[model samples]
Target: MENAAWYVLPNEADIETPSLIFYVDRIKENIRLLINMIDDKSRLRPHVKTHKCIEVTQLLLHAGIKKFKCATIAEAEMLGLSGADDVLLAYQPVGANILRFIKLIKQFPNTNFSCLVDDFKVAAQLAEQASAEDCIIQIYIDLNVGMNRTGVLVNEATALFKQLSKLKNLSMIGLHAYDGHIHDSEMRVRKEKSKPIIEILKNLSKELEEIGGRKLNIVAGGTPTFPIYAKETDFDCSPGTFVLWDKGYQDAYSEQPFLPAALVISRVISQPAKELICLDLGYKAVASEKPLLNRVFFLNAPELHVESQSEEHLVLSDTKSHSYKIGTVLYGLPYHICPTVALYEKAVILDADGNIQYWDIIARKRKITI
Candidate 1:
């Protein structure tokens, strides 16, 4: 995914169907545009769950990005191996995961690792393990701005922070306020809904700084509210999908400068009916979270209507009466590119010189070498 001085594409004949094609130029452009938007690389702590490749992480590092946010320990491990200096495991670790997380930190001593905690009981467990390992683990208090997911409520954050401060071997570094609820397509509506939550953080940061006696880093927002969060200098923005813009986000947020860097290239395999053709792009290749229409945007055959989709086949009805011969190549922009990328083991990365190479999905698997 990293752009080298010499880049190009591979022979079309060598590529198999249902393969992910990653554009090197577009990836680099996205990185540059994000940095330019932030006006400083230090303000951005991009999530790595989108593209799990080490090359992509290295690309971000090359762009002067040091901090990274990930959802899993596997992703954190990949980041550590990629020489990422600082990484935040955004999800709260529970059960045996607490010990696994501590082990990860020990393995990558050079990488400053942190995880989220909404409950003091989980924080207590983490503190115990960190104490056992004789290591101090950094933690971010997960604050629920609007999303009723994993974070502690805004009103309860300060109390939990105070409780976490008392836990042994656990450092309350900052607050993780993820407002995934404010995903209005319109920027004005998105901003309006996110304003109160932003204020909550502003107030919370002031309270924490005064009481904690230090500047507390607030990592907030996702792809939709990235622009709004970017304006706040004190908050560190963690937007994942901005790296490889997908049809879903690109259509919703047209103002974002990111290009469709990731795509699923399928081929017409069978002419089942007069105007109906079967494609190799199935639910296995694409993310089925969205509806059929929003699942993928057919680049070549925009007029094609999706008839049905199964594990390995996607039937489409071409209304234009245009006939595509069997084996004809077609490209599709997945609506949800994150899970779509996860479906594939490796990507057929195309360079500027028309040469194709493969990049392994290093963090795609569930477990690391723990």
Candidate 2:
């Protein structure tokens, strides 16, 4: 317990319950580890969806990570706020988002921006909006590489890429393949799955260059597949969770030595029964998308199992017969840090000197002056 007490703050007197705690030292070490993982930092376009704070973005920018990928406009604008070198809005923006994206491009001219397009209609609409705004929008053809979520299939995507090349305000600059479905715990299986996806992207890139007469860039993979893609010279990797890792990834990928930098601080608010104690941590505090026990693992209280959870209360059942008082503090590691991070407005930052500060989770908001 003493050796693994890096997450424990010097004092929990000022912190509120169910709040987020970030260790700057661990985050800095994680950033250093990420930089040392790859040979060339230029090919690294880390996703900013994990820690959506401008301070963290500035940390990455300071650590020499220029290119970044994000899922929302507010994140893009947050990167814009930090003057990131190249930013990719990985999601396909539609309807009013197109204008908001264009506004982002116009607002942050210092930061070059691009987006993903899986459908031709969305691409054309984007091009029309860009034309109306009198600006060009760079895009990547989002490929469906077994994710089966948003990307277009390879066979139809080539023709669509050629078709979109004729559009005036659109520039088909790259091929983006997000193999998010390949998160097997075994490294061998993960490597086996990523090989085919890499081959397809390479072949498609060659075909696009030969036929469309424009060289294309490829940015693919996330935290799960980042290590596999890091070895590839051609494909860039955008891993988000490496910045502030969680229990889910740590338990899944033992090969990745990133430290758990972020945690949720919760105190026991009530003791309803002999073995059942309720903590202030709840669905509103942590990511509740996973199962009851899979959401958050108590770092200090391994004997506690999550019995139930509600909007503002998380009830846990004790097994080891450890006596816990009402105000006992429990530090937790979230299974899914991305969604868990979104629940907090400000992260209680713990520095190396045990100093406590606040950093706004800026991109948690849907709109940040986009």
Top model number, lDDT: 2
lDDT (Cα, tens digit) per residue for candidate 1, span 1-370: 2462122233656789989978878899999999888766798999999999899999999989999999998999999999999999999999999998999999999999999999989899998889889999999999888789889988898898888878889988898988888888999998898888888888998998898898888899999999988875558999999889898898889878898888888899999888899999999999998887789888867888998999999999977768698998788889999999899899888655667778989899887686
Q: Per-residue CA lDDT of candidate 2, range 1-370, in tens?
A: 4675777777787788889988887899999999888889888999989999999999988999899999999999999999998999999999999999999999999999999999888888998999999999999999999989988899898788878888889988899988889999999999999898888988989998998887889999999999989986458889999999999999999999999999998999898888889999889999999999899999898878888999999999976676899999999999999999999999998666767789999999999987
Consecutive 10-residue window with the lowest summed lDDT within model 2: 1-10
User: TM-scores for all candidates?
Assistant: 0.96, 0.97
TM-score computed on alpha carbons, candidate 2: 0.97
- Candidate 1 has an lDDT of 0.88
CA lDDT, every prediction? 0.88, 0.91
Best by TM-score: 2
| Candidate 2 wrongly placed segments (more than 4 Å) | 1-4, 351-353
lDDT of 1 at 73: 87
